[model samples]
Target: MLILAPMEGLLDHGLRTALTRVDGVDRCVSEFIRITDQLLPLRSFTRIVPELLRGSRTPSGVPVRPQLLGSDPACLADNAARLAELQPAGIDLNFGCPAKTVNRHRGGVVLMDEPELMQAIVAAVRRAVPAHIAVSAKMRLGIDDERRALECAQALEAGGASELAVHARTKAQGYRPPAYWESIATVRQGVRLPVIANGDIWTVEDALRCRAVTGCSALMLGRGLVRRPALARAIRWHDAGRPMADADVDPCVAALPWPQVLPLLAEFWQDVCGRVERRHRAGRLKQWLNHLRHAYPEAQQAFDALRASNEPEAIAAWLLQHQELAALAARAPEVEMTA
Candidate 1:
């Protein structure tokens, strides 16, 4: 299955709604809610995961699991229980985030350095929540080294993590290319539960390679999905039965006309603009355009022209008038038919 990665400050509900509407996204995790020293109010969890009150699902009907980020096992367990009371699809612990601010706060990848603490956190959370509710952990291979990857995975598993998602890089790698798929393989080998492969899976081919290298059956897509929304659908199609006959650009990426994807972006902007303060809406649109540019190279030009404008209407008009983007916007949903 393809899981959407919980990208802090990016994959907000609007983006999750839009992306999940695209085929092949099985489920997604919410932006990690940081827990420091106390229990958060119920409103806090509901606000971040509004879908929790909406069946814990995006409008498209895909589950959106709530993820917690904290250092103290007791605090984590307390929050996990509170989150469970809301009936989230599942609870995910954040250990793979490499943000320096988060690490400095004694959360995320920083905890990967302490397998015992990681184990304790997961165990506490597992014991706090009901037995039927699933508990999962996401972590990078290691902090400065990969030697302890196996230990970390084993610890989480022993602590009752139903599954482990490994961002295939050391804390030091910090989202760089050439994610160590080999390290993910090591973690999978050492654990009995599912070990998902993540990091640098920018294309369908990258996903295939990751699964092959790590012997992992599942993939956690992050920026790659943001760049190419059709990616998971493409990977599923290729993995189902077809031989991966192409080795050049991913067929899915090749099939999309950049100009055909603009309207979708515009629609997402429309939905998200009302959710945030007016001053912040433009930045959000630009943020998506930045990632979309990775796959739709033509977006680079449009973003350059409108990066300074905060008006959604002006940006949408500008995007629509440009043949490069307008054409992509006007293009049909080829991914649905072909994928």
Candidate 2:
């Protein structure tokens, strides 16, 4: 299955709705839920996994697997048992996040450094959930080295993980150059469970290369799909020996009226800011616009004009003017010049 990676603060229901409407996405996972010592209230779970409240489908009806992130086996198991009430398609454990706060808490990649602890957590969650509910895991190669990855995979498999998704990088390599797909192949060889390769699959060629190198049956796309919505479709087409046009390069971003585009962009920023903080929202929105500029160059001008505005309405007005300019530029070539 071609799965979308669960990028925190980015893959909310609105974005998930936009992505799943495009082709080639088989399923998606939610952002990792941070579990503390407390038995999280059902309302908190519902808010974190809004899909459960919305008929177990994304706003677009895409199936989403809720991901759990924590260090305590018992807390995680309790949460998993509660999550079973929602009847998600599966339960996914997160030991792959490379964020410092998560690692510092010994919750994410840091757990990869402790194979026994990882096993205990997975085993407990596995036993807590119903037998029919599939339990899987996502992990990096290791805390700092690939040598320990096989051992970590073995531990999770022994603990009854149904499958493993291996992001081909160490914690230290966090989103760096050259993801080691070969490490995924090594893990596949060492484990008996189905392995899914993830990391640095930004294009169709990259997907083909990952499949050839890792020999895995499935793939998980993260930033690539976010940057180019048609990436997965193009990759599937290429794999079928019939490549699609690079229509993703010219996404209808520029064509959308400013009134339509600005609100969606603002909504994305608002959702993130609510989860993060006001001090960080501007920089985060700018980063998103930078990605958007890859598909619509006008996004850069809009981002520059709106970067300092704290008020969404003011930013929206400036975006409207820019969108009009882009529209005029598109039509000017077709009109005949007067003598």
The residue-by-residue lDDT of candidate 1 on 191-283, one tens digit each, is 899988899998877887888999998999999999898888778777777554556665556545565466567668778766878888888
Give me the displacement of residue 212 in model 1, in angstroms. Answer: 1.1
RMSD of each: 4.2, 4.2
Positional deviation of residue 162's Cα in model 1 after best superposition, in angstroms: 0.4
> Model 2's lDDT to the true fold?
0.80
Which runs of model 1 end up more than 4 angstroms from their true locations? 241-250, 254-256, 319-339
Best by lDDT: 1
Question: Which consecutive 10 residues in model 1 have the weakest lDDT in total?
Answer: 323-332
Q: What is the lDDT of residue 292 in candidate 2?
A: 63
